[model samples]
Target: MLVEPERTAYDLRFRLLGFPIRIHPLFWLGAALLGAFTLNMGFQYLLIWMAVVLVSLLVHELGHAVMFRWFGTNAAIVLYVFGGLAIPQAFVAGRWRRILISLAGPLAGFLLCAGVYVSNRQFHWASNPEGFLTGGREVGFFYLALLWVNLYWGILNLLPVFPLDGGQVSRELCGLVWGPRGTRIALQISLAVAVALVAYSLLCVLTANGPALAVVPWWLPRGTIFTAILFGLLAYTSYQLLQQLRWTDSSWDDRVPWER
Candidate 1:
C-alpha cells in the first residue's frame, strides 16, 4: 500500500532534489493562468523570457532560503505570480541575520541583471540591427526584455514599503533597537508608505485621459473601485500586523529581555 503523505497547515508538500517544498494549490492555479495569458500574447520568443523570469525568481528566493538555512531556521519557498515568498520559521531570532536574509533576494536579482547587462553590452546585440535584419531579432529582444524586467523587479522590491524587501530590512534594523515593539512601529510606518504610493499611483491613473484606467481598468475609475479594494487590502494586512504586535507584546515581554 502507498503511504499517505503528511499534511501541514500550508498545503501539499513535495520533494525536489531531496529538498522539501510545499506549495499552496492557489499558487499553481495562478501560474497556469499567467502562462495562458503569456501564450495568448503570441510572442513565441516570450517563452524564453518567461524561463529567464522563472530562474531569476528562483535565484532570488534561494538567497533568502540559503541565509535562513545558515541560521538554522526552517524556511520554505513559494513561487507566486509576481515573484516568490520565503517564509522562514523563527525569522525574528537575530536582527543582523534577518537583515541579511531580507537583502539577499534583491541582491541576487540585481546580480543576475548585471550579468545579463554585461553579456548584452559585450555582444552588442541591440546595436547590431544587421544580425536581426539578416535573420530575426526575437531572441535578442527577449533577452534584453528579461534583463530589464529583472533589473526593474530588483529595484522595485528594494522600495522601502511594507511587504517589500527593503521594508523588511528596515523592520529588522529597527527591531535591533526597539525590540519587538520597534517592529510593530516599523510595520505601521511601512504601511503608511504603501498608502502614499497607492495614492500616487491612483492620482497618476486619474490624471491620464484614457478609455480605461491604465493601471487597473477604465470601468474602475481611480478612487472608485480598484483603489478602494487596494486600500482595503492594505488596511486589513495592517490590522493583522497590529494584532500580531499586540500578541507579541503580551507574550514575549515576560520571557524576552527587551531593550526598554
Candidate 2:
C-alpha cells in the first residue's frame, strides 16, 4: 500500500530547491478523503485542510530529501496516495545515515509545529488556547489543522510499523544488531506493533462516545474507523511480507518500496 504509483500524464510536476517533485493525482484525492470530515465546517475549511496536508507533507519529504543531499546524493520527492517518498539517485551506504534520513522527516514536522506554536503565541493569533481550539473561526481551524497534521500525524508516522519512518529506523537498527536476520526481526516487530495499534484504534472507536470514555485517559487520541482500517491493512501487509521472507533466505531487502 505504501508503494509508489506509476507516473501518468495527469501528474503534476514541479521542482523546489533543486529537487524534482511529482504529485500524483491520487495525492489530492487522498488528502480530500482524509479531510472530508472538515466538510461539516464548510467547503472552505475542507480546502484549508487540504492546504495544510500539502504543506505539512511537503515539508516532511523535503526533510528527507535534504538529508539525502547531505549524504552526497540527489533525491526526488513523490507525493502519492499514502504520503511521500524521497528516492535517492544512489544508495546511501551507511546504516546510521539511513536512520538519520528516516528521522529527518518527523523532525522537520516537529520543527514546523514548534514554529506554528511560537508564531501564534507571539502574534496572539488566539488569546485563549482553549477558545482557540473550540472557536469556529476559519483561521483558528487553519492553525489547528497545521498543528494537528504536523504534531499528531508526525507522531503517528513515528510508530514502528512497516513503511513508516520509524519502521525504517527500526529495520536499520535491527540490522545493525542482528546482522542478516534483522530484516525478519524488524518485520515481526512491525507486525506486532501494527496489530496492537489496530486493536487500540478499534477500542478508541468503541469508547469515543460510550460510557467507557470515563475510563480512558484524557490525553489519549480518539480514533476513527479510518485509523482502525488503515492499521488493519498495515498489519496484513506486514504479515504477507513476513511470510514472503520466511520462504526465502530469512533476509529481506531493506529498501523503500520506491527503490525496490
Which candidate number has the best TM-score? 2
| lDDT by residue (tens digit), candidate 1, 48-93 | 5566666777778877887788788766777654557877766457
Q: Write down the lDDT of every candidate, Cα atoms only.
A: 0.65, 0.87
- lDDT tens string, model 2, 49-122? 99999999999999999999999999999999858988899999999999999999999999999999898877
Candidate 2 global Cα RMSD: 5.2
- Highest lDDT: give the candidate number: 2
- Per-prediction CA RMSD (Å): 7.2, 5.2
Model 1 alpha-carbon drift over 4 Å, by segment: 1-46, 72-75, 88-92, 125-135, 209-232, 243-260
Inter-residue clash pairs, candidate 2: none
Predicted structure 1: lDDT: 0.65
Q: List runs of model 2 lying over 4 Å from the truth.
A: 126-136, 209-215, 250-260
